[model samples]
Target: MLTETRRVARIVLLDPDDRVLLLNGFEPRNPATTWWFTPGGGLEGEESREEAALRELAEETGITDVALGPVLWTRVCSFPFDGRRWDQDEWYFLARTTQTATDQRGLTELERRSVAGLRWWTSAELSATRETVYPTRLAELVRTLLDEGPPHVPLVLAPEIV
Candidate 1:
């Protein structure tokens, strides 16, 4: 049977104040001022999703020793890459880090190249932020987590009429 080989796994990471971490950047291809996303990346060769999340956290934000959790959102991003529309299956997660990075740590090449900036935004602030890559549904989920506390409660989604 020919089937799509889609990757799957759990991803999660948190901030010092318990706020989720978000990344901001300008993809040369994308319009200017369109920046905002979580801190994470693809797994390295032979690396598990968990390992990749941990590694990406360090490489992108210099964050470490975090408590990882289940998948919050699995996004199928279809965008232009090298003049071709490439599909990216990204799995977002929920995690918590006891320690936070100080400004002294500074930005690394991965961060500088991939991310224009990083900021911790509360659920309320997220709505006001003119820029963010998070989907409205995902943002609402995050807001719920922040308001009610961790261990995201199950949310009932309204069924769409075909």
Candidate 2:
């Protein structure tokens, strides 16, 4: 099968209470298979990573008043979704917002269909959940960010496939 390649900007959105926000969704072709992921999508036009991150966050999570923070991590991953193989280079940014509630008004048609819901997750909840969470080791990395702060150089995560 052919692969579609893209660079994506993702957000690790946190609330005042330090709860990370994640969206619960499933593969388009396989509804029973679900996962939680940060709000993000591929860059559009000539949008910079920061612009894409903010746009995607607003569109996917309905939180727009937040400022984009430094990138905390980056990764390259290959995976199949909706019957298409994708090679995505992704950057995860750290963003904090006082806005906790989420709305789906801005989702594209595909997003409206695939996204299930959004929720704030505590470190304990993220660490103990048996369900799949994208980018892997999110719990550990988040703890590091909260405890020590963003590293000078963004960490490059090991590539993953799922």
Candidate 3:
């Protein structure tokens, strides 16, 4: 089977307390398995990665006033969602905001069904959680970023096998 590569833009939105925002979602084909991931989605036509990241951030969450930083990381992920196999190249941007209020009104039908919850996670929480999280090394990465600051060039994360 030929699998098309999809470009995705994601944001690691940090709150004033350094907690990162994540969405909990599950594959429809296997609802029993769930995972937490940063907010993002496939890019629309002609949109730059940064533009798509900003758009997805506003659409997925409700805070739109945050200033986006540089692309902090990139990762390739392959997984099955719904009934289709997806091979995604994801770019992750960093943004900080104090706002926590979210409006789910903008979510698509698929998102409404697949995304069950959203939460802010401190590094400690992320490390201690038993729940599955994508980009598996999130806590360690975030801690490094927080201590050392964003890199001059985007970091290429190892591909994740789901």
Name the top lDDT candidate: 2
How does each model score on TM-score? Answer: 0.71, 0.96, 0.96
Report the lDDT of model 3 for residue 20.
97
- Please identify model 3 stretches exceeding 4 Å from their true place: none
* Candidate 2 Cα outliers beyond 4 Å, as residue runs: 1-4
- Cα lDDT tens digits for candidate 1, 25-125: 66555536455767666555788877777677776666777788766556555444333443445666678887666241445553454456677766677
lDDT tens digits by residue: candidate 3, 25-127:
9876678879999999998999999889888888888878787998999999998789877899999999999898887677888998798879999999998
Give the candidate order by descending lDDT: 2, 3, 1
Model 1: which residue pairs collide?
Answer: 11-93, 12-94, 12-95, 13-95, 14-95, 23-37
Tell how far residue 72 is off in model 3, in angstroms.
Answer: 0.8
| lDDT per model vs. reference | 0.59, 0.91, 0.89
State which candidate, 1 or 2, has the greater TM-score.
2
Summarize candidate 2's per-residue lDDT along 1-162 as a digit string, tens digits. Answer: 566679999999989999999999898888998999999999999999999999999898789989678999999999887777789999999999999988889999988778999899998899999999987899999989989999899999999986
